[model samples]
Target: MSATFVDVEDVRQRLGSFGVWIAPMTLLTTPVATQRAQFARIESLGYGSLWSGEPPADSPMGGREAFAEHGVMLAATERIVVGTGVANITRRDPAAMHSGAATLAEAYPGRFILGIGGQTGDSPLSQLRAYLDGMDAAATQVLSETAYPRLLAALGPKTHDVAAQRTHGVHPFMQPVEHTANARRLLGPEPLLIPHQFLMLNEDAETARGAIRSVFGSDAGLPNGFYANNFRRLGFTDDDLLDGLSDRFIDAVLAWGGRDDIVSRSRAHLHAGADHVLLHPIAHDLTAAVDQLELLAPLLHN
Candidate 1:
């Protein structure tokens, strides 16, 4: 596979060192004006980037498209970069994905990063390679200049190798700092290593663990999901994954407790060789999530 034509330095310069990943589904369902205000508030809070996921077809916002949402977010904010924490490649062909990414890159310029993931067929690595090849070919046909910066949601070593060779970086989701260190070592020093860290502002250990348990449920023990498999690879035994994640597993993966604790966990990723850490604050209410972002802003910015 060939290297992406997008300028990696420009992407690094734009994304900065810290970002927030919010589903923004709540805001999307709200009135247009309110949604815009919410985005503006996040940007004002000093986050370098705002990351959102590609909603499923049955999403509450009437199947809101990721590329379209990226445009809306860019329009709503002044300086904050907006990106897909990952747009599912299985949902769209590579040509469509390339066009959507290129359109956002053209309109927002430095303010858009295209992160894509989700396995497509029998072999995910092979599918990803084909997808990248298709994107490169599509760029030649449609986009004469300005390739969009892309990040892959890679987890294991094989996928990390593919990301190192093809895309701008790897955006491993739901892994601990140990995985971040391993990814950095595998990808070497040049490629960006941006890992997502789940955050819970609650000081109560049981409460935070409960939230994580609800999120993972039976999947925590299953060997199928990416989180389970990655955790196992990182030396978490079946015992740790049983009963919706053990207390030990919760502390290892989540950035919970007081403000200081959250800050410490966030910094651990940086210390582990991550270029940037995307904090995924877990809260049902959008208002509460925004408040959490405000509270963590000073610590993260510093």
Candidate 2:
């Protein structure tokens, strides 16, 4: 199960040390021309990659299909690498996922990365292994020149083991710096380890805490047990998970306050052994998120 299909060096060379993960569905509601302009602006801001989570289409937020959105965003921008923070595997069959990823890789070449996760399933590790097997079979038919680089939405040790054995790397979302260090230890040094770091630009402490609560409050209820377990592993008590997350927990998971604070948090991940940190800035409006990115551009390592 060696990950011979992935070109890890090339992926690291392309993604660099920092990226932005804004909800792609946010742009779906806007005019197409405006969406293109915003993506272009992000590329100009010096972020190395653009990542998006795949929300359910029936959800109130109106999630677009990840591959379709990736195609649109990739076409809209010139150089910034575009990826799925994670595209859930349970939503579609493996053949469909493989074909879609292959198509994007063929069309976009090095600019696309497909990150897959199991949203709800029995034994996530077993399900992912089957999915990757299917993807390999599908790739032989659909891909002739190059295989697309992929990542697993892995957090725990078992999942991380599966990722290191089967895919290019692990994309651990909503994890703290300690988790980053632990994941790197499990993933070893060569595989790609791109962890997501939440950010809030508000200068006031309460305002930033409020922003954190607003964005991640629902995670405690997510069907997957990953978040709660990871928090406990980081020494967060049940009390910390309640009442809009304890102050210490919020501070650990989010980078808030001024620009320096956000930059410092992001740097902590890199120092903890992350190959790259995907910044998920918390803001009520898309424009505000872009503003945060603008402020962060100067501080990020190129």
Candidate 3:
């Protein structure tokens, strides 16, 4: 799409200063009632939004339908916003993505955001831009005009510009405050800039970093993926990335240790120019995730 207009200020206001972003692998396995209650509790706790990561169907990450989970999240909450952190475009046709998002938007109105990305090719940037074109064409056929914002998962400067022009703004994942600052500088001021911060509550560095590595993989080997390359651009050395993720890089990206410390890290994103920040707690299960959010709730006052 070629920058269809959206109320950027409204989106910024609804997102608030801090919110939760999680894949909810464990919760997806639970009963409908249980999932509904927990999501409602998070809304009751005053979270501005809930964002879920969508792994492609049949992948080890475990999920086929991002839209179904989004529907449940929206239905359970009376106020809090629900969104895909970034629904991979490769997983579904543009028409399907647009209609599904429009359906939710028609139901919940401003409470739904459709964030999309995950393109791979010799020219990933060109691929994503083309994907947006497809989505734009699909928007012509969407029946209802119920409004919602769209955000791109961008890292490089060019993609960031594309995001600013083509969508509301960007939803950057697994990046540090420095990246947020750079993005803000590139985007000027009005565009929505929500950076996803990874969090672990452990006090022990070894154990905490181990958990992150297991989830992220590619400790000693494997191709340098999108995230690792972004880290490199941020000045993280190969050594920092290769040694099961060095303490230096981990310390930059993860909000761990004291509750105050985590809050401080999130605030740094705000100071660096993030309109909002989504904190994803990498916990053992759903209960631990909720506990972590509850623990941070008081400190994250908007």
Maximum-TM-score candidate: 3
Query: Which sections of candidate 3 miss by over 4 Å?
Result: 1-4, 218-223
What is each predicted model's overall lDDT from 0 to 1?
0.81, 0.81, 0.82
Per-residue CA lDDT of candidate 3, range 40-81, in tens?
888887889998878754456675378898899999999888
TM-score, prediction 1: 0.92
TM-score: the better of candidates 1 and 3:
3
**Measured by C-alpha RMSD in angstroms, how accurate is candidate 3?**
1.9
Off by over 4 Å in 2: 1-4, 56-61, 216-224
lDDT of 1 at 266: 90
Q: How would you encode candidate 1's per-residue C-alpha lDDT over 62-125 as one tens digit per residue?
A: 4357877778889998888888878888668888888888888888778888889877457878
Question: Judged by lDDT relative to the true structure, which candidate is superior, 1 or 2?
Answer: 2
Between candidates 2 and 3, the TM-score winner:
3
